[model samples]
Target: MSNIVALVVIRVALDRDDQQLRRWERKIAFGYRMFIGLYALAGASTLPVAWLIARASFVSYVQSHLLYPLVLLAVVEGCVEWGLSRLRRGRHTLLIVTGVLLASIAIYFNPRLHAIESILLLPILASVFFLSPKKVWLAGILAMLAECILYWLNPFHGHESGTTPYDLITFIVELVGETVVCHGIIARGAEIWEELRKRGRLETELLVRQIVSEKDAKTDALTGLYNRKSFNEYLEFALRISAETDTPLHLAVIDIDNFKQVNDRHGHLVGDDILRRTARAIEYHLAAGDFLARYGGEEFALIIPEMSHEEAVAHVEKIREKIANIHHAELTTQHATVSIGLCTYVPGEDSQALFQRADQCLYQAKKSGKNRTIAHP
Candidate 1:
């Protein structure tokens, strides 16, 4: 019985583990979809503005290199959105990397378009939304560095044009504003994401623990089978189903014959071992629709759905033979045997009446001599 209870506990643990893994997978997929949609929308909104700026800018090199790359990034972002819609994990990362690379190359070639640093906001948000906090911070740092490098280069011939003090102050203020806003947003998003991840993990752990606790509560400590409480619950549910379907049900009460003698001869420990082994042997012969529960010390109850009295009796006989064949040498005992009492379900009968009839048969089995089965017609 202890072995059976252990098996039930293991099964519940495995099921809970599987459920948690699925929950995490779903959260990741949801986050990925949100990233793709937001990026695609941001890219679409920024593409026309990028083109207009490029047309108005004085640097021919900036218009050709920077504007073209921005448009290409918009296209890649759109493709990533479509890939996410199709449930593809691979295409999303690929497009994000490709877009970032193209944007970096454009900035490196045409430092004059440093005014377009506003575009960095998209990458900063995307990195934080989809990647870890560390990666998001790294992306933000890289954007800041790129802007500073472009500011120093002053590639639009602004340095040669002898930039005034007012222009320099305005440029510095814009740079600081852009960096502060983008960094703040990305950092805040990262904080929120981390909190959510922590909560989700905690919830999963709590749910698994609760399931295990409930399973343990329903299980018998000694025999590893369903205890009386759990058995009663199962019996009630089975009886209800049988009544609804108009199917026959069979109940059997089994007692270990001469169990007290075994305990007296071999000590209580050995006797316990014998009880566990006997329960296993009986379980091995049971059909899938049948269930057995430890009813108390040295006694077990079996419920077989859709089984008639004759069939149940025959099955009990087989179990008696199997028990007789079981070697009790490990327990330092001579022989181990079980006596069974069988009763078939009657329509509109309660559990008490059913149990009483089976118990009466058990008394008859013991009176006729132990180690045999008695059936109630």
Candidate 2:
């Protein structure tokens, strides 16, 4: 019984956590349909047997009283079905509660209504399917109270009233049987729901971790820029776009001036700081539609799509000036500067060809002097 109760509680909790309420609605509809079908089948199977027993006992009053409450319960349950179909969360709760209370009262009042005890099954099913764990607990409390009241007001009790120990035993057995069956169904449903929810949460977490891993693979750790692999991919994409649009593209190769010297003078830590600061300055000076990547070591590459050789050179000069102006707090030595080599795309040119031209211009910049931009036609 405790295990069953725990399962029901878990199902109720899953229902609340389901962000998409359509799932909850479908569950409710299926639960109600099952209840209706099961009860209808039970009624068809037992009504005739009950009628025959009542007639043999010379108790025709049993048939009329029992039939009346069953009809009323069926009607109330139909209303609950309709309410669940059309209503949303809070409104659905109200309708279901009203239906359960009506059925409980009707069963409590009818003298021959021991047969109507099946009405309680509907609420138990609803508690599992639609209501949350908190609501299931509340419904359990209400059902217990109703049962106590009905037992106290029962008019068939007494040794002299032709009622024997067998009759009392039968009544107690029926009550316990109904309670156990209803509670068990709800509990099992809840357990299945909780297991599914746990699996769903785990799957979502795995998906998030997978996405973060992919992002990390493509990004540089130091500069927070695209790494060499991503840079290659972007360069291929840019070349394709430039070819399609028949637009001239520019490639710039930038190298920090005497980066090894900075490392030896200030320490590797300060050198790393300077690299980060220079990357930021370069990023700040770049125009929209321009992209920069950490090519390798202390070198970076820029792709300026739809720009001519002269325009690319001007942009690279601005980046060089920006790097020269960047003040690093950890730098106890001289200011940092960068040199750049710019080249323009030609028809049918591949990434290697463009990189070679840019490298040649970069070599020229280093030969002429550092802290400058050199361009190749």
Candidate 3:
């Protein structure tokens, strides 16, 4: 029995945690899609500028070289935007390959134009959106290395060329500086994402803990019913609402008949079983909108909203009959019964007054040969 209860509690907590995690994933995925859309748009916008520059220069070599790869990159971005899973499945390699090919073609056309090497930074920056710090670092380093090889292989190197060694040195310095800044920004974003996940998990845990605590505070540990404290608070609240709405409130105070004799004959453990069984039997007879609580030792209280005095008496009588017919194996006499006192609350009356009247009826029921219901005159 205890194991079943523990499993239920654990399942509830796990369900809450899973819900929180899914919410975070949805937010991150949304942001990632937006980033991809902007990136694709940026690439598409650059095509017009590249086209005009190539046409004015009348350099077929530059025009063909730049146009083919820019179009290919646009296609690749579309694939990535439509299916981000492709990025995780190694399709990101297509992006890196396109970037390297474009840089190599530019360098091949004008080997001495060291400024063109800055184009390599595009692939490095694109990898930052992957949210993987290691991927970003690796892409940046590989891009720099690829540029270094091209620089050494340039045909005009060491010649009296327009591009001097100082230009190459300055380009490398700027590339390294930009890579550092980009890496720091990407790493910080990853940290912030992780922190949001942690905060969500903590908040879920706190909410689950609060629910469990509130339930425990109101429940009777032994009978598995609302305890006396909960009963009092609910009764008062119901009275106030009924008064405001002009609705009738019916209250029944039930006491187990001969409960002490059962305890003396069969021991307290068996008596406890009878109490629990009797509570279950009474609860089965109640309908929706009715409140049942363990009011005291071997006693329970029921609150029926929107019921008149006659209807309330009939309801309590049914519960009394049910309890009288219940057979319990743990009871020495093989049967148990309850005496119920029924009363309808008067409008504008305090809860204490209502309870006192109910108590008086309960006393009268006990006095007049128990196991029957008594309603206030």
Tell me the lDDT of candidate 3: 0.74
Error of 1 at 25 (Å): 12
**Candidate 2 whole-model C-alpha lDDT, 0 to 1:** 0.71
Q: Rate the local accuracy (lDDT) of all candidates.
A: 0.69, 0.71, 0.74
Candidates ranked, most accurate by TM-score first:
1, 3, 2
lDDT of the structure predicted as candidate 1: 0.69
Better of 2 and 3 by lDDT: 3
Top lDDT hit = 3
**Mind sharing the TM-score for model 2?**
0.64
After TM-score superposition, what is the CA distance of residue 265 in candidate 2 from its true location, in Å?
0.4
Q: What is the C-alpha RMSD, rounded to one decimal, of candidate 1?
A: 7.5
What C-alpha lDDT, on a 0 to 100 scale, does residue 295 get in candidate 1?
Answer: 93
Candidate 1, position 137, lDDT: 54
lDDT tens digits by residue: candidate 2, 1-377: 34554465556556757644556655665654565455456545765676677767534544444455556656766776677567666644654465466546565545364466556545545655553555554455555556555656667545354334565456555545555665676577678866887776566556556666788899899999889999899999999999998988999999998888888888898888888888888888888899899999899999998777777788889788878887776666458888888999887999999999998988889889898988987
Model 3 error, position 317 (Å): 3.3
Two-way TM-score contest, 1 vs 3, winner: 1
For model 2, state the Cα shift of residue 206 in Å: 3.8
Off by over 4 Å in 2: 1-99, 102-120, 130-137, 147-179, 186-191, 308-311
